[model samples]
Target: MLTLLTGLAFGLSLIVAIGAQNTFVIQQGVRGEHVGAVVAVCIASDVLLIGVGVAGAGALVAAAPGLLTVLRLAGAAFLLGYGALALRRAWRPGALRADPSGAAVPLASVVATAAALTWLNPHVYLDTVVLLGSVAAAHGADRWWFGAGAALGSVVWFTVLGRGARLLRPVFARPGAWRVLDGLVALVMVVLAVQLVVRPVGGA
Candidate 1:
């Protein structure tokens, strides 16, 4: 039980950090476009990654420094591209009113973007694959329980984030709110891309 709680706490701590994935999810929630599918993808991806981590894939991933390098490069490119798009949107926010039913971005695009945001980032590997895996391993035979707990954290967090986003509908009902959001998201994406460039994942 202690191990499970530890995993839950650790998982949430890592996940609750402001990052591209969480930001994307929040945006989807606000837009109300494919929120269920997006949330499912995020949660399912988390569960799979954490499970793989606990199942010993983390060791294999850790031993492959080249994989991290590839992921790092790809992640930077994707982040920069996405960031540029966000910046463009910010500069032209007049086009984007915060109507959830407006449906600017297609469902397919949203899913693809969500997948890229989650998978391409090397930090996901470091967090779920390396950190969570190592911690879970300490439980010996019961590591799976800890992993389950960690996966649950992702589920709960996403559920809350996705559902609670609607409460801000009134604020987002104005175009100004979306403009501000896009601007901040642009800044964050660019910063994260720069960080990846300066400090590639797994680099000594």
Candidate 2:
């Protein structure tokens, strides 16, 4: 039980931070376009990564510096591209409708983007697989329980983030709010991309 709580706390600490995945999830929630799909993907991905980490994949991943480099570059490129699109949306602010019934983003596109945002970010691997795995190792036989705790945390957090966003529908009804959101999203993506390029994820 204690191990589970510790894992939950650790997982939430890592996930609560504002990042590309959270940003994208929030946007989908606000837009009310495939929110369930986005949240599910995020949660499933987290579970898979945490499982892999607990299964000792972290050591293997860390052993391969080349793999990290490739992921870092690819993630950066994707972030930059997404950031540019967000910036364009901010500048134009055309599809800023708070109404879910507004022009819908195709379900497939939303799912793909969500997957890309979650998978491409090297930080996700570092947090879920590497860090979480290392921490779980300390618990020995209880590691699976810890992973379960972490998975639960992911499910709870994403569910709240994705579903709770609808409450802000009123605020988002205004075009200005959407403009601000898009601008912030763009800023976050670009900043993350730059950081990935500069630091190269696990690179010194």
Candidate 3:
């Protein structure tokens, strides 16, 4: 029980942050396209990372300072690039159109986007596999329990965010709403990327 609760708390803390993945999930949800598949990918990625962490991979990661530094640099670059693309999209003049009921995005495209957003970001591995794993390892024999709890948190949060975005589709369908939201998302990503670049050593 303690392990479960601890994992849940830790997972939520890390996953609840605003980032590219969350932004994409929410946007897809509001568009009423491929929400389920996107959510599935997000959850699956979390499961894989959390499992790695619980299996003591965190220790290996901790021992490899150079690898982690490289990952951080790579992640920052990817985030900045993504942010620029999003910003361009936001600036491009386009009217918001409601997706027809039952309309869905292409499965392959959704999967590819989800995979890129989840796996390409080095921060994901560092947070879920290294950071969370270390926490679980501290629990020793109960690491599996912590991982279970973290998995539960991931499923719950992604489900809620994805489904909840659909509920806001009506509001998002208005002229300029999507532009504003996407623009803000771009801004957020830029800020995060800049922070990562300028952050002091030993600080996240």
Candidate 4:
């Protein structure tokens, strides 16, 4: 029971961070787009990564410096691309809308974008792979319970963040609020993208 609670605490602490992935999830929720698919992908990806980490995939990944390098570069490119889009929207007057605008994008595109946001980010690897793995392994024989608890936290967080985002519809109905949110998201993505390119893992 202690192990499970510990895992839940750790997982919630990490997931609550305002990262690119969470930002995207909130945006989808606000737009009333394919929120279900995004939430599912985020939860499933977290579970898979945390499970693999508990299974010792983290150690294997640490051994392969090359793999981290490739992921770092790819993630940086994706972040930069997304950041540029956000930046354009942020600076372009009349871009922010109080309501959903334009036709809904294809579900395939939404899933692909969500997957890229999940898989490509090295921070996800760092969190689930290195951090969560180390935390769960500390439980020794009870590591699986810890992992399950952590996975539950992830499920709960994404569900709330995605589904509960609609609650913010009233606040986000203001165009200025959206501009602020997008501006913040763009800044975070661009800064993180720059950092990844400049100081990649293993100093690659």
Candidate 5:
């Protein structure tokens, strides 16, 4: 029970953050495109990474000094670039139009994007594999329980985020509402990127 609780807390801390991938997921959900597929990919990716952390790979990565630095730089770059894009979108007025004639975004593309965003994210590895993994490792034989708890958290969060967005369809239909949401997303991205850059060295 203790291990499960600990894992749940750790998982929530990581997932609650606003990142490029999450912003994209919410946008896609609002756009009425392949939402189920996108949510599935997000959940599955979290499961895999969380499992890796619980399996002790996180400790291994953390022990390597320069590796995390490289990942941090990469993550920072990605966040900043994406943040700039979001800010641009926020400044530019645009219609949220779903093309009735266009085919849905490909499943393969969705899977690949999810995988890249989840796996390539240095923050993900640090949070799940390193921080959460280290916590679970302290559980000795109860590590499996910790992993399960963390996975449960992922399932809960993603399900809520994906479905809840759908439930907000009425609000999203308002042009002004989407503009506000997009602006909020843009602000979140910029703030997160700045936080990442100014974060104390080795803070993650």
Candidate 6:
């Protein structure tokens, strides 16, 4: 029971950080487009990563520096592209409407984007598979329970983020608010991308 609670708290602490995945979820939630799908994908992905980590995938990934390099570069490229799009949107603030009535972003696109953001981001790998797995290892026999707790944390966090974003709809209803939000999102993506390139994952 103690192991479970520890895992839950640890997982929440790691994921609560502002990251690409959370940003996308918030954007989708605010737009009121397929919030449930985005949340589900994030939760499922976290669960899978946590399981893989607990199963010892972290050691294998650590041994393979080349794989990390490839993922790092690819993730950087993807982030830069996404950031460019956000920057463009911010530049043309008129294009952003808080209203869900605007033509919905296709369900398939949203899902794909969510998956890419979650999977391709090296930070997610480092946090869930590497960091969480290492911490879970300390619990020995109770590791699976710890993993379950972490999975539960993911489910709770994403669900709240996706649902709670609607509460900010009134603020987003104004084009200026959207401009600020997208501008921040773009800045975050670009900064993360630069960090990935400048400091490779697992580097000193």
Candidate 2 lDDT over 6-122, as tens digits, reads 899999999998999999988888888889999999999999999999988999888888888888899999999999988988898674664654537788999999999988888
RMSD, every candidate, angstroms:
1.3, 1.3, 2.4, 2.1, 3.0, 1.2
Q: Any idea what lDDT model 4 has? A: 0.86
- Whose TM-score is higher: candidate 4's or candidate 6's? 6
Q: Model 1, 70-188: lDDT tens per residue?
A: 88889989989998888887789766765765667788999999999999999899899988999899889999999988998999999999888877778888888888888888888
- The model with the greater TM-score, 2 or 3, is 2
The per-model lDDT (C-alpha) reads 0.88, 0.90, 0.81, 0.86, 0.73, 0.89
Q: Each model's TM-score?
A: 0.95, 0.96, 0.87, 0.91, 0.81, 0.96
Per-residue CA lDDT of model 5 for 69-140, tens digit only, reads 666666667666666665665566563432312336686875675565565566777777887888889989
Tens-digit lDDT track of model 4 for 91-144: 875877778533367889988989998899887888898879988888899999
Query: Which pairs of residues clash in candidate 5, taking residues 3 or more apart in a chain or in different chains?
Result: none
Residue 175 lDDT, candidate 3, scale 0-100 = 49
Candidate 3 residues 51-97, lDDT tens each? Answer: 99889887776677677577667667877877887777678745345
Cα error of candidate 6 at position 186, Å? 0.6
**Pairs clashing within candidate 3:** none
The reply for model 2, stretches above 4 Å from the true place, is none
Instruction: Evaluate model 6: give its TM-score.
Output: 0.96
CA lDDT for candidate 6: 0.89
TM-score of 3: 0.87
Please provide, for model 6 over 9-118, each residue's C-alpha lDDT reduced to its tens digit, 9 standing for 90 to 100: 99999899888999999988888889999999999999999999988788877777788788899999999999999999899966787575453679999999999998
Prediction 5 global C-alpha lDDT: 0.73
Question: In candidate 4, which residue pairs clash?
Answer: none
Better of 1 and 5 by lDDT: 1
